[model samples]
Target: MQVTKTALKRIVLNRLYDHLRTHYSVSLSRATFVNAEPEAHAVDAATAFRSDIEIEELQRALDRIDEGAYGTCIHCNAELPLEDIRKDPCKRICRGCEKFVF
Candidate 1:
């Protein structure tokens, strides 16, 4: 089962859309943002920014797929298991090397 670039792009876009929809709904809710203080709003903004960053990272992963680097563990250059890749589309390391990634 090959992971094509189109498949990866769809995954990234789906996640991005999910994230934005959730955030937008929260921001629109009267109870969540309307009553929040300045510090609380700042925290919410930071959280949203982090989620955006993760989505961007997934986009980079999709780009790597386009570059013919997907499924290869970045740490070991070994082909990552298809099962793991399917389970976590953003994975960059195999189970054995995952602990050492950070």
Candidate 2:
């Protein structure tokens, strides 16, 4: 039996929830090549910035759920298989139409 799209949406929501719970922090480099030494704080800040980008994408995926547009290809406007969406929440292609994307 195949899982319904609504169930997959719940899974996606759970994943996003888990990711939000974990706190990932980046560290800074102390030795600078050009200057006297790189500050450790600089490295940590950069890590946080990268993590922010991930969070932004997560928010976008969540928005798709709210829009009732999850598991559908944005390009072809076709419903992607629930299994595919479950494996990759960010995937935007159905199996048959995926070839065109490449």
In candidate 2, stretches whose alpha carbon ends up further than 4 angstroms from where it belongs are 1-6, 17-51
| Most accurate candidate by TM-score | 1
* Total residue pair clashes for candidate 2: 6
lDDT accuracy of residue 78 in candidate 2: 85
Candidate 2 residue lDDT tens string, 1-102? 255444554665544444544554323222221122112343224434456655566556656766766777778888877677767777777877878878
Which portions of model 1 miss their true places by more than 4 Å?
Answer: 25-51
Candidate 1 local Cα displacement, residue 99, angstroms: 3.6
Clashes per prediction? 0, 6
Where does candidate 2 have its weakest 10-residue lDDT segment?
29-38
